[model samples]
Target: MVVEEREITVGGDARPARFTSYDVEDFPVPTGREEEWRFTPLKRLKGLLKGADADGKVQIDVDGLGDGVTVTSIERDHPLVGSVLSPVERISAIAFAGFTSGTLISVAKRAVVEQPVTVTLRGEGGTAYGHLVLDVGDEASATIVLDHSGSATYAQNVEIRVGANASLTLVTVQDWARDTVHVGYHAALVGRDARFRSFTVTLGGDLVRLAPTVRYAGSGGDAELHGLVFADAGQHLEHRTLIDHETPKCRSRVAYKVALQGEGAHTVWIGDVVVRKAAEGIDTYELNRNLVLSEGARADSVPNLELETGEVEGAGHASTTGRFDDQQLFYLQSRGIPAVEARRMVVRAFFAEVIAKVPVEHLRDRLTGQIEAELEGSGV
Candidate 1:
């Protein structure tokens, strides 16, 4: 119930939103009616706070992903930028005060970078405010790709920091441009024996919301999260994740795969794991899987766990949603191999263990050609 923290100005520099000095408060408020943000369709999150007090500007196009990626205009008190003005940042701040000059993609400590650092957020008009900060030091290693395809319409905020015994591999591809409207927020911090890996591939967008948060503060830390999403016909794809072990010999893992086709497509998945209480020797796991090819496509899966104290050594969570298994499509149409390439070879073997952990082989063959063009427009 403490909401009086507002000073946030970008290109001319200003700061007051301390995000409660990182503990972030507001009486535990972060609602989409809770329950892990209840199926994530908050009327498209009320149009991202309706223009964040106007004064809009979003037109930036930098061609041919080249040369250590440089585009700098920071100085809104630039010390790795800031925002998330409490009220628990309206439950995970998504473009809080519309952006005013940002783009700081860095890598320079033990620098072992071989290509693979592409950040593309091409938007023109409407609402486009983005903030990105990625710094990986200490024994450094890197691979980062964030591509929000052309034809802009937007709200995006991203923050990433991984140092101390550092290692980071991040890949996010949101195929934007279908009269776009997107709200995104990603925050990650991992240190001391650090290792962080995240991969998300979402096909096209009409209305998309993605919130990815990961924190494993030191103590032999490690974290890995993988996700693949495919939504067709008048699309809507939403994903929310948070895995925090907060110290004491940490480790985390999460896996997500979703597929839905045709008529007003919608796919939603939420996975959250938190083990606090000083996180004694923790180890965590979470999983969610869904497949519903047609019949007016739709899917929803929720996996959550919160353990304050249990002197944790291991923890678990899981969820599943079903469809597409008419006896494995009649045993592949009785073996003549004609049931549309055997249902695209069983949805690519149920998405080949999250696309074989995509360490960039042409972005895993361009995400397996957008999952076989959504199974040939779902005639399969």
Candidate 2:
């Protein structure tokens, strides 16, 4: 339960952190008493709260990158860096201030690309602050892959702008060293009639906390947020997400699946959706599911929905947290499948729907392998 609900202020004299503000000072440092920080374990965040420095210990490598996709670096003050999005939390503000430079990836307007843009980030051990922006131009379509690895304390802000009528599929894999700590905020701006799909697969890390927020710039935009988190013994992984239906007739759906195995494993999923009064006829739904694979593991699921209009076509939310389906497992075993193999089949089936949505084949195969490895009890 939240401590106090009446303490939040907006505008005028003193305003608490409004979801729309950009100023870092507008948001107070979370003391775990606030609604947003209640489920998060802030003590494990290292120093991202006080403004962690970017030590240049993170190395970025691009592979299979093609032309027409330009990568440019700009100073933090660049007008285009945060033009579409502003930090809504203290960690995001601190990250923007501490980052050495901002990376911008631009796709030409109306340009169609066949190859996927791939970027590999390896942390060389130290504290790092980062900023990444992906701007998909109007009527353009592309796939982006962001892979993170190695050891470090990393905090960053990611902003993605999906232009009018553009379609984008972005895959982010957090495969870090066990000692790594990552805290980042990802915000996406979806334009009119545009489609944006994001897949986040988190596998390896000592502690990983990711926040993804979405809002519509125009009507008829469709946004889908799909995430999968697999946590093994002693690993802490959390995902907090929000989708704001600000435009009429916009559609949005969010589904996050988590699997926890072994002792000391913890996973958290928080999903919130707000349909403003102006957003008439907006359709939205959010669902969070957790599967505990073993003893001494924990999964926390929360789904919140705020509707300000009664004219919406459809609006709802759902959450489910429990162990594996024993009946299904028994049926699989009775069909002559080995116990381990049967369990694997059920787990794969649980995740296959989301993984199949990945537009890239090689990337899908890679994610499948990681999931299989996790099911097989492989150590990170």
Candidate 3:
């Protein structure tokens, strides 16, 4: 199928526009040749591209709900269900139209929640669809964790809103069983003087694709997006991110790292940032790095930046993909460290920066152990 190319005018600059709609029929089935779906494997999606009905089930459970937090179930037409997010792709649009109910988690205004909220979704089997909304009130502070496990074919949409002067940290862990296929879209809106931090950790699945986007609702907004991926033999993992700076004095930073091992292990990372003319004084930077640990593994990294006004404070992007650093490994071995132990140390250090940023101690420790386990299983 040939998809028409469209562009939108932003501050006198014409740029490619992403087609989005609430109707599933508006998006034709992807053949894997389109720019947005090029790296994804269409067959592994398990009929999601055809907008099939979600006949499976995924149990949802929440823990650590404090006094200031509330979780409720609402229908698709709820006022807050689609306020912060719109479907940007075929799978997401299908999920929006198929989900029977939506989950909404709200934090009270000016309230502080000391405990971290954890949402767990366990898939039973077959195909499933889901929608989730997280709303942080003005001046509120909270931490959230979304954990995915079990086995099934799933498509989901997550919407997040950070009110004025609020702070939110979200950590998403994708630890699905081996034979599972999943696709998710995460969209966040940052308010004036607010801060948003997101960390995505993808470890298991047959084929997983995640698209995360962020936009500024007011000036002085700040956002940071970080991701980590480990792809084993015959696994496919992909992450795509977009940051839109439409207000002045906003800032955004994106960093992602990937480790590929075993034969047929493939990973892809794409980072895109756009600065409009009204976004003067905005500072943004994006970086992506990939580490190949064995032969026959592949990694692809792409970083794009578009600036409408040259008056911005600073803007830059960088991407690098390479094998293990021989010099670093040699230096560690020269210090009397065993070859295997030295290799483990190097891999730990590579991911330490991103893992250290997690506020929860137990989660950080668990991630560390998982990475080590992956290395041991691969005989690295």
Residue-pair clashes per candidate, as listed? 0, 0, 0
The parts of candidate 1 lying over 4 Å away from their true place are: 1-77, 82-127, 132-152, 160-179, 188-205, 209-211, 218-233, 240-264, 268-280, 287-294, 298-312, 315-317, 323-380
User: Against the hidden true structure, what lDDT does model 3 obtain?
Assistant: 0.90
Error of 1 at 143 (Å): 33
Whole-model lDDT per candidate: 0.71, 0.84, 0.90
For model 2, how many clashes? 0
Candidate 1: RMSD to truth: 20.3
Ranking of models by TM-score: 3, 2, 1
lDDT by residue for model 2 over 294-342, one digit each (tens)? 8899998889887767789899999999887989989999999988888
lDDT of 3 by residue, 54-142 (tens): 78888899999998899999898788887877787889988998899889999999989989999999989889999999999999999
lDDT of 1 by residue, 1-380 (tens): 34345444422333233343223233354456766456666666435543444334545443333444454657446876653222134423435345667776767677777667777676654656676777776767788888887655566667778888888898888877776767677778888888989898888867787878887657887888888988887688888887866578788888888888788788887787867666788888888888887788788777778776678888997788787788998988897888778878889888877887788888788788879877877786
Clashing pairs in 3: none
lDDT of 1 at 178: 70
lDDT of residue 103 for candidate 3 = 91
Pairs that clash in candidate 1: none
Better model by TM-score: candidate 1 vs candidate 2: 2
